[model samples]
Target: MRMKIAAAAAMALTAMPLSASADGEVNIYSYRQAYLLEPLLNAFEKETGIETNVVFAKQGLAERLEREGRNSPADVVMTVDISRVNELVERDLVAGVKTDTLTGNIPENLHHPEGKWYALTTRGRLIYVSKERVEEGEITTYEQLADDKWNDRICTRSGKHPYNIALISSMIAHHGEAETEEWLRGLKDNLARKPQGGDRDQIKAIAEGVCDVAIGNSYYYGNMLMDENQRPAAEKVNLIFPNADGRGTHVNISSISLTKSAPNRDEAIALMEFLTSPEAQRIYAEANTEYPANPGVKPTGLVAEWGEIHPDDLSLQEIANHREAAVKLVDRVDYDG
Candidate 1:
C-alpha cells in the first residue's frame, strides 16, 4: 500500500574523498559512486530547495562516522550491506525511529526490526546462465549450480567478499550450517575460473564464453546497461531468479540510517521518509537498477525487464548473524576454486 501520508526508509575501491562541508546542508558520506546517485541528489535538492552534499567513500565511512562522534554534523548515513548497518547500530551510531510512513512502506524483514535502519534498494545475488550454452530449465535454483552438470564451468567473485558472505549467510538461514557448507563445497568444485573481479567481470566472462553460469548481484547488470560504456558486458547473459520453489533467492540491500547524534534529527527522519516514499523508491529502483524496497512501488524499466522475484523471507539480521559461519566454511573449503 502506498501510504498517502508518507513512508519510511563504497568506496572500498573507488574510495573517493569525503566532502568536507556544504553550507546549510546535510553531509552525506555515501558509498555509491558520484555518478550513480547524482540524478537523485540533484532531484532532492530541486524538490526541497536544500542543497544535499555527499562525499563518496567505501572502507572509511564507518570509521569516520565513529570518529566524528558527538561533534559529527552528518544528518544521515547511506551505505551498503547488513553487517555494516548493524555495525552502526552496534556502535550506537544510529538512532531508532518510528515513522508511520516507514512502517507502512517497508516490510518488516527489509528494515531494522527495531527501525534503526531502513532499506532503500535491493539486489538479488542470483544465478546468471549463458543463454546459448545452458538449457532454460536446467538451472533454476542456486542449489542447482552445484550439480555435476555444471562441473568446472562456474565463475564467481571471491566468497570472502561481503556480498558472497551475505549470500552464504542467507543459505545458512534457509538450510542450516551443514547443508550450506556442502553447497559451498559443491559450488567450489565447479569453478571454471578462479574467483576474481566484480560482478560485471563475472558477467563479462559469461559473455566471453568463460563459463556456463555465474552468480552475481542484480545491479551489476543494471549499471552495465545504464552506463553506455558497459553495454557489451550487459548483454552477454540472462538473469535467473533462484530457489523459487523453496525459500526464494537470497537478496541484499543498500540502506540508510540516522546518526545517533544527528544535528538535524527532524531533517534526518524527513529524509528517511522521503527516500522510502513511493516517488523516491521508484527513482532509486529505476535509476540505480535495483529493486525498490517499498512493496507498493513497482520497479521501473530496468528491473521490470529482469522479471519479478520473491526475496528470501529471511531477516537481514539472520544473514549478518551467520557471517562468521559462512567465512569459516568458505576458508575451509577453499571457495576460490
Candidate 2:
C-alpha cells in the first residue's frame, strides 16, 4: 500500500513537465512544504518571467528520481539537512553547478566543493530552558548537558532522527568517536523521559514541567511563538545557543541541488541563482523565519530578536562525513532505547 501510494504520487509529479507551459518553467522536487515555498517561487516567477512547478513530498524523491533515471522531469531538488543533499549526490541524481552568482553569494563551507549542492538558509540546534527553573549563565555549552546535574531534567527527540544525527555528527567532528560515544551515553542517561515527539513537543514538555530543559532547532522557537497555544509554552523557556563561548552553536541548513538529467538546465540555473540573490533570500528568510545563508542579508522579524547567531565554524561537508560514525555511536549507547 505504501509503495503504491508513493508510486502514484511520483507519477502525478512526473506527468506534468516544465514544457507543458509556453513560458519556460523549472520543475522542482522539494522536501520543503508548499506553504513555505510558494511565496518564494512566486517572487522568482514575477522577477524573471519564468514559471515554477513544484512537487512537494515529505520523502522518497531521491528513490523516485533514481527509478525514473534519465527520463526524470525534475529540474531541481530542494531539501533540508546535509544528509539528504549528500544522499542525492551519492545516488548520482544531481549534477555539479558553478556560477559567479552562486559561488560569490554563498560561502564555500555551505556549498558542495564540486558545486553539486548549495545551502539557502540555516537553523541552529538550540537548548530551550525553563525560565523559572534555569538561571542565566547556568548552562552555556552542549558539553554541560552530559553533566550529572541535568539528569532526569533534559528532553529531546529520538537520537536517530536526522536533526539529532547531524548534531551528533558535529560532536564527532569536534571530539573523537570515543569521546563522542561517551557524551552520547551520558546524554541518554540524563533523559527526562523516553525520547519521543518533534522539536516543538520538547519545548512543550519544558512548559508542562515534565522536564526543565529541551533540545530543538532555533526556528521552532520562533514558530511556536507565532502559534497561540504554543506561544504560552514558548514564552516560558529561554533559548540557549550552546557552545557560544567555544566553537559557536551547532547549525544545519536547508539546501538545493540540480538534477543530473535536468531538461530545463538554463531555467533551473536561473531559479537557483535567483534563490541565492539578496531579494529572494530576504523574502525567503522573512517568510520561513530562518537565518539567510547569504551573509549580506541579515535575519529579520522574530529571528532578529533572538540575537546574533555565531554559527560554528565547522564545514558542513566535514560534519556529513562523520554521520555514519555518529549513527553508530547512537546505537552503541542505545540512545533511543
Off by over 4 Å in 2: 1-23
Score candidate 1 by lDDT: 0.79
Could you tell me the lDDT of residue 40 within candidate 1? 65
On residues 1-337, what C-alpha lDDT tens digit does candidate 1 reach at each position? Answer: 1101011113231233323344345556566665666666666666666556566666666777777777776767887777678778777888889789998999999988788889999989988888788878888888887888888889999989889988888888888999988999999889997899988888889888899799898888878887887887667688888987778878899999988867767756777887898888888888778899999988779788777888898889768888888889999898875
- Location of the lowest summed lDDT over 10 successive residues in candidate 1: 1-10
| Total residue pair clashes for candidate 1 | 6
lDDT of 2 by residue, 102-205 (tens): 99989998999988999999999999999999999989999899999999999999998889999999999999999998898889889999999999999999
In candidate 1, which residue pairs clash? 7-101, 7-102, 8-101, 8-102, 10-58, 11-58
RMSD of 2: 3.8
Residue pairs with backbone atoms closer than 3 Å in model 2 (clashes): none
